[model samples]
Target: MTKSGHDILKDRLRRAMGIDLQTVGHNSLRNAVARRMRVLGIKETRQYYELTERRAAELDELIDEVAVNETWFFRDDTPFTVLQRYSRNWLKRGRGSCLRILSVPCASGEEPYSIAIALLEAGVNGPLFKIDAIDISYRALRLARRGIYGRNSFRGRNNFFQRKYFQKTKAGYVIAKHIKHSVNFIRANILAANLPILNSRYDIIFCRNLLIYLDKDNQKVVVSILDKLLVDEGLIFTGHAEPGAFADSVFIPAPYPKAFALTRRSAVVCKPDRVSYNRQILPPSLPVQPLWFTELDTARELADTGQHEEAMECCEQYIRRHGPDKEAYFLMGMILTDMDEPRLAIRMLKKVVYLDPNLVKAIEMLALLYKGLGDDNNYRVFKQRAGRVAARNQPAGKGSE
Candidate 1:
């Protein structure tokens, strides 16, 4: 049988750019392709597939559709806080002549710029540090170079820094010239054989959240590259959902909050709250009740669909019946989060983490909730825990939802 248009495009994309369109869901890929076709005035699917191969510009556009570029300045402030502290200490000690930071797949430059702002605010001299930011998308790179962002990039309660660093204009908040100059933007593929920065070593590498999109083999490849890019004592920071992928690597988990900083194995130190969530501790192999699992699923669906009260009720019933069920409590916490009750949500989520410390999502949400409440210490602590658990529990080669 002839392959469907989506199947053909999916295979082509997987081969060309290592993107699994099917993994993102068939409908999403189809719709994106349809939109691209409409924009390019290509009515026939077969011709568009050929165009994707023959025309580099067209292929880039399609790849942009698959690329997830959702990011904000100081998205999770924990890492920046860690960076600030580390940079200050490093500078004080005179350990390195200059601090070099790399932000791969930098996603419109929010991260690297945020790093600049954090370090500068930390009293580190602007010229003492340099940031090299790279992304696969030219469009995103263009925006990053422009250094202007709208409301989408300015989120959460931390607008103080934004107001300090950015000048508000009709288009959006324009990043200060000094911050923009501190970061050097480049366009390159992470998996390319000749990555632009392969010869250089960085004090810190922010390869956050890029690995989830890759398959298992590619994840390994990307990590290997990052390991080489990092200086012997330098750190690599990842997303909350990525620590599990580094279990066997030479990187040791750094005990910083939601920073997901990993150091060389030889440099592992006793971090104050070094989490050990990788130990697979499942509830004993006793036969699980199907009905209870079904209720948990129902509650999760309800919460996801914004039926917070109904979900909470379902979770409450489960907890009452099962006696502090981890999943139930976690669902309750998520529901509370939807209901805008951060304290209650934190209580339930903390319970969930205590019951099963490897509940990655619970720990992550707790971090966010704490951040909302301006509890910096707890926010970083839970964020770090979440990264460890996420690294342990995340399946190989799946994209972020």
Candidate 2:
């Protein structure tokens, strides 16, 4: 296909599905399209393009090829902890008859199932809650409804939850009956014109790691749709890379450690540092630590807000005061990446891995940077290391706001 033909194909795909083919990588998009042509016995790129426009089912198959569905049960455990507290408080207050939760693009069902298990452990029974899990990929939704997962889905330090909620099978871990029954999986696209009109409001919604894949315009559209689907004062949980996307939205970060949950903005203004919503809150006073320790969080906040220069300065101050903390370096590396300084970003990220070999994120970033730079050898090396480290001591309880 000519370059113009490829560009046409990309534009058609972006219009069909709100996903930007560019984010999936040019080579990957072309490969997926070529692979699909072979599968359908289509002769040429133009033929496939026409089929994609005419046949919705074929377009969905193409989306499945490029979709990134990497997730695990209790992937980040802190949000579940916060949900437990939220469920308990809702029960205590008799706020509503039942809690309604939504997990859009609930890849492989790990997240929604995790929420159900957490609510169960918190004494919030099935009668008191309902979880709706939706995704655009029929392939993923099929696997989710099967309620079985492999070892890769059971990563991190939450084996107890697995043991309690899943039955070990020769094939994989089959989710327990009760846990599997808790969530309803539906095939729906968030960008569909009628999505908000079709779905009822939810008390809490989990739409993590999804907006980062979308371009800015689509991100705003999805955010607005989410806002409409949420009840007033409802909470939303997003991925670490997404706080900046919501910086201008109708949400405020929930006050909890490693819980990247946000509450809908109401008429009354709420302070960021106060977890007033969580009744059983931990006091802010920590046993007297150096002022520098507190500065790390300040630097992280600055970085999260996209004040890269200010955040870098804060990290520099911390390094001068304490001489290179691993977390500080990792944060600095992330800030530099956002600043489009790949060389400085690579240096900082490498320093993070040198200081703490188990820092999986730093290694993963290094692999991506190498891949972007066409350094296939280093990319493969760091990618392997990242996977190994991730399998062993998968970090938890730390993410964006």
Candidate 3:
């Protein structure tokens, strides 16, 4: 008996591509086969499936079409936040060293470009830093190399980066020369048993928001491969929503404050002079985080409209993105305090202090909020801490306001 068209498609797609049409759902599979058949000039689905089975290269091309490719520049904030922090510190530590990064499933190349831009922003330059980007689609790779997109791509673009990083042309907006030069985009399938293009280790691997589409087992396999590619003492950045995907290893969350990035825990984690990661039970008094003002302005507007709920939610969203700034928590605390939610205000202000120990205004407001809630002990403690920190960080003639 001759097999049906659907049967052939299921078998060829599964065998040739490791893509189980059964897992892809029958309806979606049917649509994809139909699309490919029309493009391939196969009069019938059976003929198309037969072609794919007989032709390995055609099968590879078809697989690229079926794979997911949806992405945008700076799609999530946390990973970029992690990138920014690591670049500053790493450049300080490993000056003149080659810092390499990989962007898996780098759909259409915008992501890799963004990472390159981030590296530039963090002051990595002069041939010391490099980026290795990959994607499954030759089609997407072509577009990425062009480095030109509609000016609308810049609309509502919360980053002022492009104003400095792009040049206007009849060909559209070309990426700045520096960003374009730092990155290398290769086209390859990440799901394959082996990756030929990426044989070397990298300082960072940004495989964000891509694994959620895969089956559980495939997700694990891909993650394991990515983990292997990451350098010891390197960093990994992913989506906040997909944290459960990587609930393993010494992959503790790095404090991006507002964004999400994870640092690889080496066998021996080093200690910086001012900050000690080990033997440190001290309260977090680090600065709130470097603020990316372009994104911050939107969150600020959300607060001005009395959309406290949305304002706070936006604040939380921004925090998960890696661009944590001290002002975010302070804004949130002010909203709660105004609403007479003193308890929440005190808690939020505590976060501000951890982020910026010398955030005197936060301490003052927090003390008042605590006193309103009958928490005199906290009010006194915060007040004293604020006084001492102000005196310490303050200029000799300057006093705490």
Candidate 4:
């Protein structure tokens, strides 16, 4: 494709999905375009560009090729913890007859399914909550509607939910019928003028990781749409890199460690440091933590909120005060990975794995870091190790229906 044609197609993608070509990478856009052209048997770039202009369906096809749908169940784990607590409160207080939640760009089905599982575990019955899962990729939506997931979708150390809510099948793990029924999946771009959910208001919105791919102007536009869709005191859960997108908007960070939640400025009834909602929901029997533990918690929260420098300082201090701690090293590895220092992150993750050989998350991180650095030997070694550890730690019984 010529440079001019590529530029025109990039602009069209920006207008259609609020995507920043630079963030998605120029090479990725070029590759997606080339793949679509090949699939359509078109030889000329100009003809393909003209076809995109003439047919909306062709543009949609291009979008399916370009969209990034990498996600897993309980990706971060903290946001769902926050949601469980918040839903328990909503149910206790009788805030409404039904709690409404929205998950946009809910890649595949893991996120919405995870949300349902969290609520169910929190004792919120199926009839008391409604979830709307939306995505723009037709291919991803089809997979989501199938409600079947491979091992890649179930990451992390916990497979308790998998054992409880999914049936092991030859194809994959088939999601429970009730959990699949709980989420209503729809295919529509969130940036469209006629957004499907404009007429509705939600109590909770999970818009994680979508804003980072957009330009500054589109970021602001998305924040406005989120504000319009949220109720007066509703919460917005965003990705760790996305809190800055709402910094100048009507949203303020909610007081919960690692939750990455925000609420309207007008809803700030309590001080920022105090977690009144958490206190209300936390059981009285819960134990208190040591001062050093709270400091590490603060470091995790800082990292989640994009204060990488401060977070690194906190980690350094923790290491200085306490001798080489595996948890601190693991946290440092994660922060370094986010800062694009794969080598440094690899060192930290290696220290973590050395201290606790069976720590599957750290092992997985080492595999990914090695893969990123193009060290296929080390990557394969750690990848195989992680798989072995995961298999040994699997829940007692095979998954049941």
User: What are the per-residue Cα lDDT tens digits for candidate 1 across 101-195?
Assistant: 99987989999998899899988888799899998888789899999899999885577797789999999999999899999999988887878
TM-scores of the candidates are 0.66, 0.66, 0.67, 0.69
Q: After superposition, how far is residue 178 of candidate 2 from its true place, in Å?
A: 1.6
Q: Which candidate is the best by lDDT?
A: 4
Q: How many backbone clashes does candidate 4 have?
A: 0
Residue by residue across 218-336, what tens digits does model 3's lDDT show?
66777777777877776677765655666775565543334556665442122212322112123343444432222233344445556567557766765766566566677677768
Sorted by lDDT (best first), the order is 4, 2, 1, 3
Residue range 1-401, candidate 2, lDDT tens digits: 67887887677666655777677676878898889999989888888887877888888998887777878888788778667766776676576678999998798899899889989999999989999998888888989999989999988686688777888989899999988988988888888886643558887889998888888888898889988888885778889778777879888665443567777655221222322222211133234432112445546655666767866776776677568777777777777877889889899999988988887778989999888889999999999999898777744644222
- How much lDDT does each candidate structure score? 0.76, 0.77, 0.67, 0.84
RMSD to native, candidate 1: 17.0
Candidate 1 has its poorest 10 consecutive residues by lDDT at 271-280
Q: Once superposed on the true structure, which residue ranges of model 1 sit more than 4 Å away at CA?
A: 1-5, 268-401
Best by TM-score: 4
Q: Worst lDDT window (10 residues) for model 2?
A: 274-283
RMSD of each: 17.0, 17.3, 8.7, 17.0
- The global Cα lDDT (0 to 1) of model 4 is 0.84
Q: Please report how far candidate 4 places residue 280 from its true position, in Å.
A: 15
Give me candidate 2's TM-score against the actual structure: 0.66
